[model samples]
Target chain A: MTYRDAINAALAEELERDERVFLLGEDVGLFGGAMAVTKGLYERFGERRVQDMPISESAIVGGTLGAVLTGLRPVAEIMFIDFVGVCMDQIVNQIAKVRYMLGGQVEVPLVIRTQGGGGKSYAAQHSQSLEAWFMHTPGLKVVIPSTPADAKGLLKSAIRDNNPVLFIEHKLLYNEKGEVPEGEHLVPLGQARVVREGSGLTIATYSRMVGLVQQAAEGLAAEGTEVEIVDLRTLTPLDEETMFASVRKTGRFLAVEEGHLTAGVGAELVARVTKNCFDYLDGPPERVAAQDRPIPCAPALEKATLPQVEDILTAARALVG
Target chain B: MPDMTVPPLPPETMRALLQGMMRVRAFEEAVHDLYQRKLLPGMSPHLSAGQEAVAAGVCLQLRPDDYMVTTHRGHGHSLLKGMDAQRMMAELCSKETGYCHGRGGTMHIASPEVGCLGANGIVGAGLPIAVGAGLSIQYRGTDQVCVAFFGDGASNQGTFHESVNLATARKLPVVFVCENNIYALSTNFARTGATPNVVDRARGYDIPGVTVDGMAVEGVYAATTTALERARSGQGPTLIEAKTYRYYGHGASDHRPYRTKEEEAQWRCSDAIQCYGDLLIERGVATAAERDDLSARAAAEAQAAVDFAVSSPDPDPARVGDYVFA
Candidate 1:
């Protein structure tokens, strides 16, 4: 199944499993979502459960937060992660802080599903990875799934979590097909999956970057450099144990991410490994991330700016050296 | 236009309305005193001393299951909607016994039991939330209506326009109540926009918009009653702009440098509590002595709440991370 199909399956299954679960966002109902992830949900759940909202991003988030406050579990889509800037106050201040600020009296069981990444050449306004922005927030749970099965499992988990969660889907990974589990599949959040195992080096990444790093690791293995790849399914409650264990075995670490290099998720991972697993390190930790600049619409510039397989291989080689 | 005639309510009902207004007034008065004593932390209190009638009128029409979202200056609305005074005072004092365990101070008090979703610190933020609650009610097939209490300044926010349009498009059960106190902090309402009245802007949303004398409790009650009826009957939302005024400045330390003393005196002459009390006595709903006694009781209740807040213990420092998640 494709990652898009897996997300749709998760939403459909959750909607069927719980009566309080509903979908609300722009083009979610009639247009079947901006990326067709919610295709046919309107017909299946009807218009009442599958709601189409206005172009207002603030209302989409604020409305979903409000619905969660009162007895409904709503999965709201922001279409793209770049557009989150329009509703930062609602996402950052209101949704992220509501549960904690309310002293746990109310549980904000809300899932904000948005797409990020820059390979499509959608220009500066549309294609920017902003996972670091949410990871910095205190009361939010940020999740970015790299594979079809993990996407399905992690989305289901995010919907079930009593706190608000930001479920980031990479736009580039939507068409990537893989074997997703058939029935009752649930991947517990805050748990990392070791996709590829090796003793030479540990390559940590998530979302679309995981695929690039895995490919790079395969190429590195051809050169006698066995690189282990760890896919962090969730970011905020980061699977530090799995990361630390992988780094301890490998004695070398390289963090890869599609977001900006400055204060990005890769920076956080590299910092964590340096802090906890310093004694086990064979060499200094390294990071492979996008350059500190907006993603341009030109394909060449965008590809150059984003972290590619070659960049990961270079970072892995440096860490091994 | 608002119906200025006294609502033909029973003597007990009228007395209750007067007492509700008095409670709001007394509560805010005590908040002013508490701030003066430096007991409350964070931002200074925004008192709703002259706007009690709007709170009494609108909240009295709501059932316990009906939801409400208020603005930063929302103490009056919360109190009238049945929020516990002790817990509210505790919240103002930043104690663990507060509504939000001292995390959400004055601007973020919320009580789902009382149907208050929360008090928003951002201008016009609660409008969409109220619309969402309205959508939830419609989805669940409930008769409950969600009331959004915003200031006139918030009416200028894009959220106000967006939420009203969505509520109208979906025909949701939500009432947009604009408490037009004529000032967004220092900026006067007239200086902010070309439209003279907030209700006039509701025409673009295709909803019924009405203006009521906010200082007159009966007028506000009558307007809100009609709006609630329309919402409960699935007639969609109504924008009711209450023409009110704030007797105090924007915050506790704000001296009235923006406006003249004469303009302040002009608004104070139509204070909601004083006018409502006079109306109650004139209509023979209650004797003057009875009205005075009710006011005194309200003051005593406010004092008791302050005492409870003062005696409440501070939150344990060890449990600071208790409510970050679920």
Candidate 2:
């Protein structure tokens, strides 16, 4: 099945399971969502459940937070993750802190689903990836899926989670094909999967970068350099054990992402691995991230600005002692 | 949903509502005097001097299970909604036994047991939360309703517009009680916008909206009961704009520099105590002696609350994280 269809399956399955689960965003209802992830939800689940909201980004987050705290689980879609700044207070302060502020008397089981990454050349405002902003908060859970199966499984888990989760999607990975299991199953948060096993070196990534890591692993293996690949589906309760185990096995690590280098999730992972497995490391961990600049609208500029398969290969080979 | 029927409530009901208003006015007066003596500390207490009717009337209609989300200028609302006066006062003093363990202080008082969601220091932030509470009531199929009491200043915030639209659209059971006390900190209503009446803004949401006499607790009581009945019956939301005023400065820190002395005097002349006493007599509800006795008793009650607050033990600073995450 396609990655977009699996997301659709998760939405349909969630709506079928709980009467309180609903969607609210611009063009979510009749238009079937901007990426068509919620295409049939509007027609099947009706407007109330798979809802359509105004272009008010701040209110959308606020309203979803309100809904989640009161009793319902509201999954709000911000057309693009770049516009998250519009609702920073609702996302950062209100939603994330409600559970903690009330002294844990309340729970905010909310999900903000938005498309991120800059491969589409959508330009400045529409193309920036800001997952790090959410990662900076204490009470938030950030999830990104590279395959359809992971999308469905992680979304199912996010729906049932009692904390506020930022369910991020990549613009380029939605249509990719992958094997998805049928029926209800959840991918637990803080669990990392070994997308491919190797022994010479380790490469860890998540979201769209998973494909790049896989390609880089294949190319490295052909050159007699075995690479252990790990996909950390969740960033918050990070699977530092799986990462550290893989790093200790290979004695070398390389982190990758589509976000900027300086404080990206990749940097955090590398810093933690370096600190935790300092003696086991064969070489210092290196991060290959997007250039720290606005994503230009031109296809060539956007392509060069983001980390590609060649960049991943180059960074991984450099990590080899 | 039940229809808005203006019922002639029991005579004691009006007396009860009026008494609540008097309690608020008297408490604020005491706080004002205490401020002059430099006793109160922390956030500037925004007195509910002329705006007592809204809280007293609306709280009178709420069931014990219903919830109320108050604003920064929320002493009247929190007190009238059954929050213990001693705890509230202690909180204002940042005492250990305060309503929020001193973290909330005046603007952030919260009581889960009494269904008072934390009073917000930020404007326009509580409306959506109240809507969420109402949604919970509806989703769980409970009889509870949530009332959000905001001010004229909060009415201009974006959350007000979004929450109101969402509430009316979903037909949620909630009340948007606005105390239109003429001023937003330092700016008056005329200085803000052309829509002089706050209720006029409610029409855009298509909810039943009204403006009532802020002086008469019965007027507010009657309106609040109608709105509550509509909400409890699953009808929808209502906007009640109580055109009241505050006699004291915005906070204990204010020197009354923005407004004139004559303006303050005009509003102070209609002190809720004097007006309610006159109303009870005019309606033949109570004798002059009884009213006098009630007034004295209320003063003593206020005194006891103040004593309890002053004598209450401070909280241990070590266990600050208690009840944070269960």
Candidate 3:
């Protein structure tokens, strides 16, 4: 199944399983979502459960917060992660702070699903990975699934989570096909999976970057360098144990991310590995991330702006050297 | 204007309304005293001293199952919505026994049991949430109606316009109550909007909009009753703008530097609690001694709440990291 189909299946199952679960967003109902992930949900669930919201991002988020407080579990889509800037107040201040500030008086069981990545040449506004922004927040659980199986499992987990979660899907990974488990596949949040095992180096990445890292790992393996690839399913409650174990075994670390280099998730991973496994390292940890610039509309320019497989390979070679 | 005919309410109902306003006034007075004595925390208190009628009148019309979203100046609304006075005082005092276990101070006090979603700190954030609750009610096929209580200043917020439009488009069961207190902090209502009245802007949403004298409790109550009736019958939402004023400054420390003393005195002359009490007596609904007894009882209750808050234990430091997530 495709990653998009997996997400659609998760939404469909959750909506069927729980009466309180509903989906609302721009073009999500009749338009079947801009990504077509919600193509048949409106017909299956009807207009009441699958709703088409107005263009107001603030209302979409704020309304979800309100609905969750009452009884309903609302899965709201922001269409694209870049547009989250318009509704940051509701996300950062209201939704993120409600559970903490309310002293656990209320549980905000809400899932905000959005897609982010730069490969589609969708320009500066539409294509950007902003997982680091939500990872820094205290009350939010940030999840980014790399594969079809992970996407389906993580989405179901996020839906069942009693706290507010930012379920980020990579725009480039929607069409990527992979075998997914048939039923009741639930990947717990804050757990990392070792997609490939090796002893020479640990290549830590998430979302779309995981594929690039895997391609780089395969090329490195051809040259007798076995690279361990760790796909971090969730970011906020990071799987430090899995990362530390891999870094300990490989004695080399390279964090790859699609977001910008400066103060990105890659930087955090490098800092964490360096601090925790300083004794196990052969050399300084390395990182491969998008350049600190807005993604341009041109295909070559956007490709150059983002970190590619060659960049991951070079970063990995340096880390292993 | 000629004398308006006062609606004849039962003696019990009249006393209840008067006592509700009295409780709010007394509770705010005690809170002010606590702040002055430096007994409470350093947070600024947004007192609804003069706008008690709007809170009491509108909330009285709501069923226990109905939901309400309030503003930063939400003490009166919270009190009338049946939030425990002692727990509310404890919350303001930062005691663990508070409504939110001392996490949400005054601006975010919530009691979902009484159907108050929360009191928002943002200017117009509660409007959309109220609409969402309305949507939930409609989806569940419940008879519950949600009310969003905001100020005239919040009407200028985009959330207010967006929420009203959505509520109308979906015909959500909700009521939008605008407490026009004439000022958003120091800014006058005229300086904030192109329209002279908040109710005038409701025409664009195509909902029933009415303006009532907020100082007259009966007028607010009557308008709210009609709005609730319309909402419960699935007639969609109603916008009721109550023309009210704040006797105190925006916060406890704010002095009378923004408006003229004459203007302040003019509003104080028609204070909601004072007018309602006078009307009750003039209509022979209650005697003078009975009204005075209610005032004493309310003052005693306020004092008891203060004592309870003061004596309440602080949260343990070991549990400080709790409640970040469910």
Model 1 error, position B122 (Å): 1.2
Which parts of model 3 have CA positions greater than 4 angstroms off?
A: B1-7
lDDT of 2 by residue, A1-321 (tens): 998999889989998999889888899999998999899998998877876776777667877765665568988899999888877877776777665555455677888899898787799898877888888887889998888999999998998888889999998888899999877768998899999998888888899999988888888989999989899998886889999999889999898888999899888988899999999998789998999888889999988898999998888877783
Candidate 1 Cα deviation (angstroms), residue A96 = 0.8
- The DockQ for candidate 3, computed on C-alphas, is 0.80
DockQ of each candidate, alpha-carbon based: 0.81, 0.30, 0.80
Backbone collisions counted per model:
0, 2, 0
Candidate 1 lDDT tens digits, A1-321: 999999999999999999999999999998899999999999999998999998988888899977887899999999999999988989898989987887888998999999998899999988999999999999999999999999999999999999899999999899999999889899888999999999999988999988888899889999899988899989988999999999999999998898999999888899999999999998889888999988989999999999888888887777776
Runs of candidate 1 exceeding 4 Å displacement: B3-7
Candidate 1's residue-wise lDDT over B71-116, tens digit each?
8999989988889998999999999999999999999989987899
Candidate 3 residue pairs in clash (backbone atoms < 3 Å) = none
Ten residues in sequence with the least summed lDDT for candidate 3 chain A: A312-321
What C-alpha lDDT does candidate 3 achieve relative to the native structure? Answer: 0.91
Candidate 2 off by > 4 Å: B1-9, B23-49, B82-105, B111-115, B134-145, B206-208, B229-235, B287-326
Pairs clashing in candidate 2?
A103-B324, B96-B315
For model 3, residues A214-304, the per-residue Cα lDDT tens digits are 8888999998999999999999789999999999999999999999999999899999999999999999999889999999999999989
Measured with C-alpha atoms, the lDDT of residue B236 in candidate 1 is: 95
